[model samples]
Target: MRDLFMQAVAYTSMWLAQREVFAYRDEALQNWTLPGGVEEVQATVLAKLRVALDYARSSNAYYAGVFASVGFDPLTMRGLEEISVLPIMTKDDIRRHRSDFEACESMNSHRVEGKTGGSTGQPLKFSMSRDDYLRSVGIGLAGWHFCGYVLGDRVGVLGGASIAKQDAVPWHISRSDLALNRRQFSAAVMDDNRIAQYWDYIARWEPAYLRGYPFALAELCRHRPKGCAGHYRPRAVLTTSEMLTESDRHIIEKALGAPVFDGWGLNDGGASAYECREHIGMHVDTTRAYVETVDDAGRPVWDMPGRIVVTSLTNKAFPFVRYDTGDMGVLAWRGCKCGRSGLMLTQILGRCDERLNIGGVRTEACAGSWLTDIDRVRRWRIVQDGPLHITITLDVDAGFDKRASEEAVTLSFVSRCSTVSIAFVYAPLPLPTDGSKWRSVVVLDSARHQTRVVAEKHA
Candidate 1:
């Protein structure tokens, strides 16, 4: 009876949030239901791509100018291979011409604002129309459905400030959480006391499944309370936002007694791929984005690993066409053995950088959220040389206010780790060497402290 009641509340909350989410989810499921072989599915996806391309060519200002300059017309294009004529878009391009990327027709639609530091730790603010935002959510819900997660099943989400802010509340549970039958745990603060509190909440809540960053889940496993796994066990664990290393996967599985399902996606609403029950590789979500592998020169590559490029299908508000994701992956031409078709990524080799941990707390990508809307800041980097000391280097524009930004940075870190020391360094931050993805947070000797945390868990 309680389960039925929670499910009812979940459906009600989802309806209140977005009236069309379920419809979008149904639309996304069409990919799975498409009749016939792989070629048929590919044809359907390319049809959508054709629509997206033509929309950007006619609607988006940036694409309009680029299309004119290159003399490439999606309307005149004969085949999918012709898409290669479009130039690959870099992060710098979007950073400079963000406004021009928006479709002129979507100006009147309500916009949902978001920001990401991306792989380079350079902040970029983006938005999508209300309909596009709901579509993205629907597509994500479809992915969760593939993982055997039903809406309204109790879920405990462990995430950063972006997902669940570190509020003043003791349990960090919010009203919206109750409405959806979800519990929120802070990934920003994982000290011993907080970890203990999290476990207590989990034991009582007995969530049907748990979802969080790989590092945060690994930390929970390392310091999990005695016999905590005995009292309750989740059906499955979902991990995302960071690379899920094999070591972390093993640790989490051993601690929780459930299979760890990992996925990869961009915050920009561009592309996403999730691991099905097959556990072989992530299935490219063709319903939301079109993904492919390409060489540095924008030519498609299939025999070897190459840069991952994406074109968003749902987000017409800010069309991302031929957008270079600054990540490396290999696309398998074959379909999954699990009988699912369309697109599948054999591997994703991106965001492979060390994490910053002060004591038991490990910080991920939430730093991007902290620095959002700051006008003076251009690009930023976080470096940890000592255990409790962090230095933030910022590349500022003219008329930068050091005092205000410094206070903001200090308060952000100190709120998560009260004992940590914060310092500021101003300069033009260095670039990644030889086309490598930039290491956002650099920890000089992270392994030493990481080992200590595990050792203390045993003690």
Candidate 2:
């Protein structure tokens, strides 16, 4: 039967992915697996960082010049702080001089080009060796296994199709998916008809696991039309690209009849954080990349939110050292009950693009300062429309001070922000829309791949 054939293909794909990840990973960075105690993990990650640094120093012209100018030596580094000696990479850096970042020796080497997907609305493209690409995918597979997946099991993926040939998946579906035992549905387009089609795919594929952007899955679940029977009961649903909020998870589980787990990753950073069976916090893969949270002065801050900077240990092709991810988070070293030795990222607050730059006054961390004081108000969302006009919606009970609440909310938003006509409404919490992921702070005109409308309170 066709079903049996797909399962066979899936098993073959897993076998190949496993073989490719481990085999080719060493071809770039030896000892891809950084298993063992915390110190061992730290040592392994640092060693790989040096390997990538050394390669970049020699084969990457831009880094070489920058290192020479700064007189920063990766091989003879004084401490981890010395890494801050290297210039921080940003999207603007990539945009300004993309080719300079490419490994000088990659002229004839096989490579895979990828783009970063987050709130910035603009995506950056970078290249890594084809083998390194497989290695990252292998790590992803390992994460999936942690959440209850076996090689060759039927799987379904929901992702926005870029619509352009360059954005279109460059790989063969059957050769990869059939061999990998998975299929993909378009998350880019989510009309009712598409939802119906997605349901049909699930009923036919009967996937053991489902995965995709959190927003896409939530939309499908929200707009699930009646009369379609989805017999496919996945053991677990995997969400990535965007943070999964507690409310979003509850709704998804209710609709799909499956427990949900989250995958945390940055496309350009080559790092991943995934939840285990314990489901407490995401176990970050420090082996592939080193993660740090630093205050504005570039000092590490604990128990407080800071800018997330990442250094890719595995990416020698374009050693992204101390890359300012522009996202905010807090990492906890107290550890987790899951017994995973790797470092854990306890919180990822939101992306820089998630901030409401009302007239220029940032209202992310301080928005709650004023909104919570309003009487009978349960929650509030700051929605930014195309013209940057603001709308503050409050969820309140009967018999509340609407006028006072509006004044407080407006005062909170327009603190120093430029002139703006604002709208205030009292209603229930706004549910998410399929067109985009939900955001407590939204720019109706902006979609930064990095924004998280909602996520598990704990993560």
Candidate 3:
């Protein structure tokens, strides 16, 4: 009875809030529609950058002082090419001068305190203003156009993101999730019975669009308890937070009966990118931020995967100019066949912390294909605590073997690194109380190194 009452309250509130959600969809359409192709995109990018820079310099004391020191003027930038003249920054730089980063007057309109889980294991707190918050929603709504989704459409999110932590109501019945017409089920609580219950909920809900962490949703589809393949196929499936491999994409699309649209973004509000229907490459939100790749010498590169640098264009409350997000990827020069005329990032390499530095091995070689064995396990997380000490946690299924699993993990590492002591913890995997979880690999024994990367549109 209480559940029904909450559902009633949620439905009524969302009906009242549908107007705002519709407006957000309309605004996203207006913001995303670039009719002029490449030239138009370039013009819009230049104009927005110019305006954002001027506003930051004029209203932000920190930027004002920094610009004066370098004798830099935002007004002088005639083209996107001029962005190169600005200095690239990192999270530490933002923290050291955190107080100086805000443009208080303009930022106070919709300010809310924000913090990042820091995928690289370094968390940071910051502020999120009105436009800062809404513009992200706008981009996400816009991306759904590719999925044939509009505001007020049913959206079911399957994850234990902090958004699920709201006290107002159950995630599926919350007014907040109603924007995409979203109904959410917690990924944090998972086991045979709970998963079966989730399957029952989803079968009944029959959402139009599905969104969540890749592993969470994939496992649900993988282990739907034999006879629970409900006739509920969504129009699209959206994955985010961590990297999405081609193999993962194919498996998900095949199992869920929906095309997958992957996205990437930083928790610090630095960058955002999403995959379109084409599924070839992700289109970066050039309107919200600028993405650039640099070589070992810090010189910009167009094609190769190098250190990625992100500059946030919208967040005046916390401007991230050329901030290193500590994830690596290659940047492509040409336009996507989907006809979107903007720079795109491809081949996302996980964080610098996730990189195997000892064997001087590439990521694919070191991480191996353990994820390919998703059929045996429900989910997996690996944390490298020390130079040679590692912890492997798994939420395995009925047929899962402890001895075989240990052998697989140990072999994957021993073939790559020596003197590695492995600890296997087989228990139900817990979802983060915060947002999306990152940093599956941690090297606590060594000083932190930096790199760059992106987000899922829903991130």
- Which residue pairs does candidate 3 place in steric collision? 162-434, 263-455, 263-456, 264-454, 264-455, 264-456, 265-454, 265-455, 326-451, 327-452
Of 1 and 2, which scores higher on lDDT?
1
Q: Tens digits of per-residue lDDT for model 3 on 1-459?
A: 434454465546645744354355465454445677656766777887888788778877777887788787888888766666667676787767766765453457656677775556578777766566666666766766777765566667776543344222223364366533567667666566877877777777677778777766776777687667557788898887777755456567877788999888864655777787777777777767777887655667877867788766777776766677787888875567776756777767767556654333334322324544555565566665544556777776677667765787688877776655778887886545443553345555441221111112224
Worst 10 residues of 3 by lDDT: 447-456
* TM-score for each model: 0.75, 0.76, 0.77
Model 2 TM: 0.76
> Where in model 3 is the C-alpha error above 4 Å?
1-36, 102-107, 166-172, 178-180, 359-439, 446-459
Given candidate 2, what's the lDDT at residue 70? 85
Best-matching candidate per lDDT: 1
Better of 1 and 3 by TM-score: 3
Per-prediction RMSD in angstroms? 14.2, 7.7, 7.1
After superposition, candidate 1 runs with Cα above 4 Å error: 102-106, 117-119, 166-170, 352-459
Question: Local error of candidate 1 at 231, Å?
Answer: 2.4
Tens-place lDDT digits, model 1, residues 1-459: 788898888888899878699998887777755676567777777788888888887777788888888888776666566788788887799867766765453563677777764445565677776777787788778888767887788988876644455442226667877887778776656677878888887888788989887767776776788866566778899988766656567678877888998888785746877788899888777877888788768988874677788887767667788887766777865677777776778776654234566756755433444653344444566778676788788776678777766777778888878998878787975333221223446776665475466659868
Q: What is the lDDT of residue 80 in candidate 3?
A: 69
TM-score ranking of the models: 3, 2, 1
Model 2, 126-196: lDDT tens per residue? Answer: 77656567778767766776676766677777755321121222133645665766677755466677678
Off by over 4 Å in 2: 1-8, 13-18, 22-36, 103-108, 162-175, 230-232, 357-381, 384-390, 393-422, 425-440, 443-459
Query: Candidate 3's error at 316, in angstroms?
Result: 2.8
